[model samples]
Target: MEILRLDSFSFRYPHTQRCALKDITLSADEGDFVLLCGASGSGKSTLLENLKPELRRNGERTGEITCLGRPLQSLSRMESACDIGFVMQNLEAQLVADTVRGELCFGLESLGFPPEVIRRRVAEMASYFGLGKLLNRSVNTLSGGEKQLVSLASVLSLSPKLLLLDEPASQLDPVAARELFSMLARINSELGITILLAEHHTEELFTLCSKAVLLHNGQVSFCGAPREAARFITQNRTLSSDAIPPQTKESGSAYVFTSLLPSAAKIFPDEPSLPLSVREGRALFKQKISGRTPPAPMPVIPPTAPPAVSVTDVYFGYGSKDTLLFHDLSLTLYEGELSAVMGANGSGKSTLLKLLCGLLKPKRGTIELFGKRGAKPTLGYLPQNPRLLFLADTVQQDLTACAENLRLLHPEERIQSLSEALGISDILSSHPYDISAGELQRAALAKVLLSSPRLLLLDEPTKALDPFAKSKLAALLRGLVQSGVTVLFASHDTEFCASYCDRCALLFDGQTAATGAPAQFFGGNVFYSTAAARIAAGFSYDSVTCGEVRNLWIK
Candidate 1:
């Protein structure tokens, strides 16, 4: 049965001329797992928020919405609260309690559940989500991924029939993201709960989703089975000029959306059928390269460049009583290099960046910037939460302030160039908080670049970006590196690191476990590698990125 339905729904935020969602007619059946996907600011989040009345934005809304055979707006507050659950993109925004246990019990208590029942539900959620050890831990000390899990558990404790998630795995590592997806699948299959998730990371989800919906410019471009949706997207790129929409054609939305597909889909777009997973991709790859010789391995060159940032036996921790998060940690970043620091959640990736940017001082170690022991060099740092970087109300104002404060020459030209490159030119007049998370990330990056820092440090730089924006960022960073700037970023995006970064460092148990070239680093790992590497591995190929695999196949 259809549990929810919308008939020609339209919504426009206050003070905005364009509707955020336009003529959207959609439905979700009971126990269905629907995948919502689109480019940044494409109205996926807006639609999701509109479904939950309590969280819906103040907007000019029109049309009919039904839930369980009744009007959505007619449902009682308690009924809606108990039937629909939402997990927001920002993990910290939803968490309320101090400890994991308390957070799990918050929703239950709010609804005035019996103490015994609340206890039972909390225990079950904690055990099910593997939060047993963290139950007593402070929520403030939890990593972004851990906090996300806690928020999910808290929502699940309410036993809602329908779950809505926005980029739930954006902050999770590969293994953890896989596990989260698996858990979500089980919830849909075993528990019979319907799920509608909006996410950019569709590699694993593409195969799991019962249905996929693609949105573009506030409209449903495609809504069908996942496989059919994949084929439609790939096939649409070859359509005639008149067949495509003018705005879409000009923006190359087809190409941008194609990049959001799975690596196998991207690599074999013209195939009779696209493979959705690495296993199937490997099988197809083996057949394609059956009689062909593998490409020669790329040479590994040792770095002879001077050090840009050096850390010697660093020890650091948060508060006075907190245990040391980093002990005897040492690493070096050479000039004109783009390096990535990757590790599991709570493994100190953000902490290491903070130390390098002088936001946090090491307890017992030496940190030198450009061969000086205590010198402070010009640098740009983008934190995990892009909202923290915003000082002015509007994006345009914030960027202008940044450029002016830095005494940049020709500030208007610089701002305009960066805004266009980062795809934030249209939203410059909007408030910084009004834009999408991905848009906000790019805006923050534009501000950071306005400084023209010699060294750049980023924490989770690709947290909410789509594939097209990532490519733009990669090209921008490449240009910076060519101009003799050095960059060090911490991320959980193994695919981005493998494709664009020069070196990858793995941090485990408070120290650098391994650091080497991307090919040698990700290619050597089993679970921590990209899908392209895993697919190529079947043919004894060491290709770690889709570009490399595509180039080799072409050759």
Candidate 2:
């Protein structure tokens, strides 16, 4: 059934000159999984917000929005509950309770649902969403992916028929992302729930969303099949931010995404589509080349030292896991080296980072950064949930809020430069809560950079960023590494691991499966290897970074 419809919708924010939604019309039937794909600042979220009036503030609208033949404005707040369930990008913004069980019952309780009914629905939703284990855990203890699931389950606890997910999987790990989407698919299939998801990645969504809609600037530009959208995006490389629908697709190792990329990137694997960022994708492609192993080029480093970081017998994990994160996991990161740690979700990759940053006391292991221990390591750790550490109000304040002893030297210079590079410069004065998730992350990164630490620890650094931001971040990390700094990041994007990092360490089931050259290591793991990497004969030493592969080709 066609559950929702928009007719000539046009909207503009009070102070803005440009219309956030321009004469837009769209429709989705129950059981249809529709995706709104686009870049950051695109109208995907704006359009999604239109479904709920609470999401808007003193906005002007000239068109009609109808849900089940009734005007959107006329539907009672409680009626919309059983109809459309909207999930915003920022989970915390929507979360209301301290504990997981409390959060699940919030919406149901608001409606005065019977206690027994709430209990039944909550338990069912928790088990169905794989959140039963987290029912008693504090909301603060959950990871990004876990929180997203909790939010989804909480929404489901209300028994809504239509699900509106905004950038839903942007913060999830690969395995969890896949599972979450799969669950959504089943809900649509069995329960007849109509799903409309707005996201940056589109490749995976292509197969899931029966119909695709691309909003450009604020207008409906491409509304058609996934394959057709993919062709349109691939052919038009010069789409303006306002003229093209945001699209991202998984092509190979890297996500080939842009306003021009297909919609699969955001859908599958929770990876972004490369908007012409093929450093890692190309590197993986080159690795498959067989005939003769190409000779390696002269080393980029000028006869530099061997390495900077060394970890031996690293063992760490949560209670009752019955295994170390990495038993006998040994690896070293050379100075001026950029390495990516790749693996499926829950691979203890984050734990490995904790050991390196001294966030966790290793159970039975030793870690040496710059050949030292028991000292404040020069490592800058970017935790998965950065917003928790934020105490200041304004973006500028957070970046420069520290006192003399802890203050960054010349923070203004670094903040302005890094902010512009990461595309968060315009919102420097805005409150942290007012900005986009992508913008906040960039701002946090700028703050981290201000400290000028020698080693950077990034846990899923690319979670909510768009292609442009991702490219800038990659370049910035590269620049840092070239300037004698080192980076060790955990990520699910195989293309990123291949293109930027000098090496890759694979983690699985709370242990390091392999640590070596990305190109070589990726070749053996189906979950880690890129499409091009698999197609290419094989990699030389699991080398996944583009510079390495390009030099290897040249030689």
Q: Which candidate number has the best lDDT?
A: 1
Residue-level lDDT of model 2, residues 236-341, one tens digit each, is: 4433322232333333211223422522221111224332223334443444344565444223333256667788877775766584456767777777788888
lDDT of 1 by residue, 105-154 (tens): 88889989999999899899988889999999999988777888899889
Task: Name the weakest run of 10 consecutive residues (lDDT summed) in model 1.
Answer: 239-248
Error of 2 at 140 (Å): 6.6
Every model: Cα RMSD to truth: 2.9, 6.8
lDDT of predicted model 2: 0.69
lDDT of each: 0.86, 0.69
How far in Å is the alpha carbon of 181 misplaced in model 1? 0.9
Task: TM-score each candidate.
Answer: 0.95, 0.78
